[model samples]
Target: MTNKLISLLDYENKAKQLLPKDTWQFISGGALDETTVLRNRLAINQRLLQPKRFQHAGFVDVSTKVLGSIIQLPVMISPAGSQSLAHDQAEEATASASSRVSTVMVVGTAASRKLETVRKVSNGLLWFQLYHHGTALTEMLIRRAEIAGYQALCVTVDVPYTITAEKDLRNHWKLPYGTEMANFTCDEAGLGIKSNTADARQYRRPPHVPVTWDTLEWIRSLTTLPIVIKGIMRADDAVGCVERGVQGVIVSNHGGRQLDGQASTIEVLPEIVRAVGQKCEVFVDGGFRRGIDVLKAVALGAKAVLIARPVFHGLAVAGDVGVEHVLTILRNELYEAMALCGVNTLAEVDRDLIYNCPSTAPL
Candidate 1:
């Protein structure tokens, strides 16, 4: 009999072997030195866990509510684009898998499936991740996303300029033939994009307008889907979201994709949480691959956490089923970690369960 495959780390190893070198690099590479990429997870591991061995494990309840919706776990899928590179099922498969695990799916603007198709495919709650392409394209996408039944619109505000990963550049990675861009018309995306990516056959990050605090209102005007502003690394920005009346803030640095040397998402989570801990719900993601990491974020006051690359690895190996397994693995891990830490319910997790490590000391 074949041994059980219960861990996402096992799936990650399998995915690396199955995917092409270029695609693998694009999925994993961070900008420049990638110091922050390693820092993201390492920082989380630096956190010390004190076990209360005598406490009763009791009923393990990891369920938490985000943007007023309760989820089985604090983890959710971050919007990853170009699923065609990992598997043929693309966003449709991801949507189905996220639902299977009962976690919210954050669909990307660059998804291979059209916004409508992803909505149809999703079996659970959904959120649409937006790229600031220009007001017209942005508005149209928002309107369609609302019609498609997404619960929230996550505006990714960090990547104004593109970072061409050296691996994707060296590999000359290109999409397979017959891939389609379902959201926009063929004529709208004219060829002369500043982004150097050669594989972008039809689209690139929108160049017309970059996002600013002022841009939030324009997006608000488009639809009622609660806006979740992602890519915030500072406490001031977290506070800004509360002022803007946005529903949520993702404490992220684009998984260290945009600014290579910035603080790991874990390092900034506490500050952001402290800033708006009372004003709004804060979700954090970066270097968070373990159950302890989710607890760390919740202890620091995050309402939820997002896992970006691991989901891709799972998909590359087994499509929707793979992601489902990954989420379940994390859910189980969080349960065990919580029980070990002497807590059960999500609300029971607080600052007493966490402490900042001095390894984060000046280095």
Candidate 2:
């Protein structure tokens, strides 16, 4: 069954069929009317790639580095919680697959597998994705991640409060019984619950502590790991990240899960890239599903692009093998795209390679 999955969309289609209907909605649906979700794909699809003629160099290299970690391709796995919903091995399988492809995987704060347990299986680069639960718990998770040998810290800043998707609310979606938020199960951390689910309709929400620049400063004081801020949607906010000594910024709308009607990550990537300039590495995540999407982002000056739902789809289809195939497909497609564009490496990609069709032009 896995062998037949050729593209990320193939895995997504197969995963939808294999997963329960409610679970499918949980993975596929977004906030409110999901206007941002649809726009994310539409924005990317509207852009045209300009292929150069007779400029092939007979080779194309998709490899690049983020925070000094060399990756075989620019695509990295976005950290998502409760991956056990897709497969029992969960993050461990995803980690193994990232290692197989020589790329990075950011393990989420709400991962079903403990950070230590996931680390034991993979020798590849791992970055811990943090949601600020509060001072003590956040500190504890940060300490645990550093001790567990994660290379960097990615702080997601956009989710100030939990917003249950309308689809999940309508379906009354909840984590399956026995699904443990392994990191939070420790009594020492002050969360005594076995699982995050407290009721059929509600799950634990990260405490809504007001995260100010002071919070980033405090987090900086806790660990020496390079800090990458996720969920930056504005140029001013991105400049704020750079001003506060952040090492990187990911232009993301939380896969359009946090807010509705926000600009897609690709729509804002260029300005954030221009605003940040060479001061810090800028990356993006939302609505990226193909090699061409990745190329468009790199051409717009994104250091790399992270992917979330497609990784979940791949995991749902065949665990680590499916994840690897999904990545390999993108890499092969990227090589083809780069070759067709008369480029040999990511460094050669620039804004001129992209021809923004009139329909997608910003007003």
Candidate 3:
């Protein structure tokens, strides 16, 4: 069955068929009307590619570096939580797949596997994704990740509070039995502390600690690892990240899961790239489905693109093998797309490759 899956969408369709309806909705649905979710794909599709016909390139190199770590391709796995919802192996399987493909996987704070346990399973670049629980808990998690041998700290600054999508609320969605936030102990997560009932779902409802730019500074003070700020959408905010000595900015809107009607990440990638201006690495991740999508982003100056929901699709379909297939599909598609566009390497991809590029137009 896994061998039949040819594309990411194929995996998605298969995963949907296999996963429970409520779980599928929780994984696929987005915030409010899900307007931004639709817009993310629309905006990427709207950006036209200018293919150069004459240049004959023998081979295309899709490899690139992020935060000084080399990857075989520009596509990477984004930090997503409750992966156990998709597979029992969960983050361990995802981590193993990432290693097999020679890419980075940002392990989520809400990961279903313990950070150390996930690390022990795979030899690959792992960046711990941090959700600010509080100063003490945040520091503790950071220290744990550092000791666990994670290379960087990807602090997710967007989800200040738990924003449940309409579909999730409609279904009264709850974490399935047997899956838990393995990173947090029941007591540390405040599970059963108040009600005396051990509800694992309490892990989703962490204290609302607003993550401001100052919060970045505080996190910086705590870790020697390079910091990558996720969920950045504005140029000024991206520039602020540079000022604070942050190493990277992932231009994401939380996969349109946090807010609806916001500008898509692709629509804002070029500006964020311009604002950062090589001060730090810039990456974008929203509505990236095909190789052409990856090419469009790289041409627009993104260091790389990260993917989230698709990883779940692969996991649900065939565990680690499906996850590897998903990454391979994108890498192969990127190679072909680059050849069509006469791009032999990521360094050759620039604004000129995009027709009427937004980066060059007057704002």
Candidate 4:
């Protein structure tokens, strides 16, 4: 009844209480000691915002270009699997929510519904997330995604090997009934099952070949959809992706879901941008909870930002409406920050608006 549903902070408070404890831990917890997870927030806090003087103090814009497409805002939905856990709508509901907000939503390969169904619900731009189980299946999904009106192919390359979260192990977390891997029926071993338990807290590694830079050439042979390489953190990898003729690259740490000790995406954005900022559109994801956070990433040179976890929280609390509210909060916060910082557009926001803070700032 209060103003609690109006902002992201209040939504966060509600989602924690609404979702199952194990689900909450799995969605929010990072791998290992979660050093990178905690550090992600700290890294953003350390960024010092530099304010400009009274110059052209009017008419601010939030719209920006990403991968040759003009998006309403610099925020995007990072491709994440297991949305069915949060709502009955799952991918379809989440996609529709993104449409309501005019933001981009990247659909995961492991979604409960296939890309064809997802495109039908989403009103805004769409990008299909690929975690290729094999070439035949990969080409099948890619072609289907393109056929279904997807604008791009966002290939996730970070999780070749899956790590079972201990939290899930403790809670016996497993995929509920009616949800199955939509892309392939089974792994390379001919085992139709993906998880060892009801919650799928643990999974055996399938024999899919390691994803490498050369895989780009293989992908190029399959479809014409713009290929966006996600889950890159190192500058060299960013440069390599550009050189490989990738249309876009998302600098991410897998939402702190994979490795735990790596540097936060914000801490590495500047260097990655320097390395490949000019070659292609460089986007970033990780610890993007506020408008100031998005501003920090942009000022550091990210073309845009992607979000995970929060979207799930929104879905958990209020389905599509909750997702809409979550994105609106971030978008509204970003606009306010831009106005206060005296920037009229994304390009106007440069490194001048941010510097590393001495304390809590990464050393």
Candidate 5:
């Protein structure tokens, strides 16, 4: 069955069939109207690669370092909350898959398994993704991650309020029973979700501690781990992150789950990269289903790209093997793309490798 899974879409299709209806809707749907979801893919398609075929590209080397961590490819798993919905093994299976490929995995704050369990099961690098619940909760989570052997702290700063995806609302989805965010004391954590009406949904928002540019310094003071700010799209925000001592920035739009009409992550990648790529590592994620999309991000100056939905699709279809297969397929596709573009190493990928047709068109 895995042999027939020729593309990432294949896994997506298979996973859709395998997962429960409410579970699939929660994982697949985006914000209200979902224009952002469509925009994410449309923006990526707009940038065409200027392949320099027949340059004796030879063996392609996709390995590179992202914020001092060595990954086998230019791809890393994005942090997505509540993994048990996808599969029973949850984040543990994902950790094993990442370790098998020697890439990094940013364990979500709402992961089904505890941070220590993920760290103990996987041999690869782990970065704890911090969603601020409060000063105390944030500090406790960070300290736990440090003790559990995580490599860095990726602070997700975009979600100021609870997200309200239409599909989730229509389905009245709630966090599955027995699923608890393992990073904190179950009673003190209070990170689990419960049912609520559509209008009252935003009002009954989860425990998302508000954070701003000022919060970065306070977080930095809490731990010595390298800070990677996620959910930054604007060039000024990227610049601000670098100026404020951040080690990395992830150019993302919350996988089109936050704002419904905002620009896609790919559409905003070049500007963010230009603003802070030199000073701090720039990463991106959103609508990146193909290896070619990964190549385009690197060419535009991203240190690496993160993938979440695709991996979830893999997990829903098969456990650890499914996740591993997803990574392998993407890695192989990226290799083919690199060779076709006549680039032997990630260093050879640059702005010249892509032709922005829209930018060159007559205004």
Candidate 6:
């Protein structure tokens, strides 16, 4: 079954056909205008892999460690909310497939399945993502994840507002009945969100709360888990995370669903990586649909890459089987790219393996 998927786009096409209209938009649509969404892919395609020929590179080893946890490949599943929209099995199926491939699955705060439930089913690394709904809710999730034995905490910092996607508005999309924010569905969780802070009111839509740097520090005080900040696009933010003792920083634009017209994650990764230096591990996501894209990110100094929509595409198409197939395809492609670039190990993959190659027609 895995052999049937020769590329990530195949999974996407199948997913589009299999999923309901509303569910598809929720997964595929970006923020207003979607310029940043398209820009993410364009920035990636513009970078060319400068493969080295006849260097006699041997067997490629794609395995690498993320904050001391070794994964089979440099690819990991990014956090996506309510995966139940993609498959009946939901996050459980995705977790099982991620474990089967020996990689990490950063469970979303809005996952349809509870974190513990997903953890119970996964034999692989699990990291819980948080949206900083508020002090109590944030603490509750951190404590629960710690109790459940999650390895790390990834705090999403970009979505200071709930900018409803344009496609969702057009389709009048809503979560199907029965699916819930498994972590916060209970009343005891306190609605799982708060109004945006005063400073962020201008940037946020109604009912969306902003988590400030002070809030980040507050979060850091509550748990001993290694905290990684997601949704960062600026070099200064990366530097600040390092200075404040963050364990990692994920260079992302919230998959272009938070801010429209912001620079793509790929476009800003190099600067952030250079700014952060070796103070902390740097990861990236957005517009990563191929093994070559993975290689391009690695060469630009990303420790590893996280993918959200592609995993959702696979889940919608063929459940766990599609997910495993998608991961395997990317791994195989990364292996091939490494061999062609005269690199036998992840360490050998650096800026030297890439060059600027402009593209005219990105669509």
For all candidates in order, the CA lDDT equals 0.79, 0.87, 0.88, 0.80, 0.85, 0.85
Assess the local accuracy of residue 8 in candidate 2 as a C-alpha lDDT between 0 and 100.
Answer: 89
**Which residue window of length 10 is worst by lDDT in model 6?**
197-206
Q: 229-253 in candidate 4: lDDT tens per residue?
A: 9988888987877777788889888
Better TM-score candidate (1, 5): 5
Q: Please, what is the TM-score per model?
A: 0.91, 0.95, 0.94, 0.91, 0.93, 0.92
**Per-residue error at 225 for model 3, in Å?**
0.3
| TM-score of candidate 6 versus the correct structure, residues matched by position | 0.92
Model 6 segments beyond 4 Å from truth? 186-208, 356-363
Decreasing TM-score order of the candidates = 2, 3, 5, 6, 1, 4
- Candidate 3 has an lDDT of 0.88
- Candidate 5 residue pairs that clash: none
Q: List the residue pairs that clash in candidate 1.
A: 40-287, 41-287
List candidate 4 stretches off by more than 4 Å. Answer: 1-3, 185-208, 356-363
Tens digit per residue, CA lDDT, model 6, 179-245: 6576765433445432233332321212435878788788888888999999888999888888777
Output the worst ten-in-a-row residue range by lDDT, candidate 4.
198-207
Which portions of model 2 show Cα errors greater than 4 Å? Answer: 187-204
RMSD of each: 3.6, 2.1, 2.6, 3.6, 3.8, 4.9
lDDT of each residue in 188-293, candidate 3, tens digit only = 3432332223654465455658798788898888878999999999999999988998999999999999989899998898899989957999999988999999
Candidate 2, lDDT over the whole model: 0.87
Q: How close is candidate 1 to the true structure, as a TM-score?
A: 0.91
Candidate 2 C-alpha lDDT tens digits along 31-97: 9989999988988887789888887889899999999878999999998988988887899999999
For residue 73, what is the lDDT in candidate 5? 93
- Note the clash tally of each candidate: 2, 0, 0, 5, 0, 1
Which lDDT value does model 5 have at 103?
96
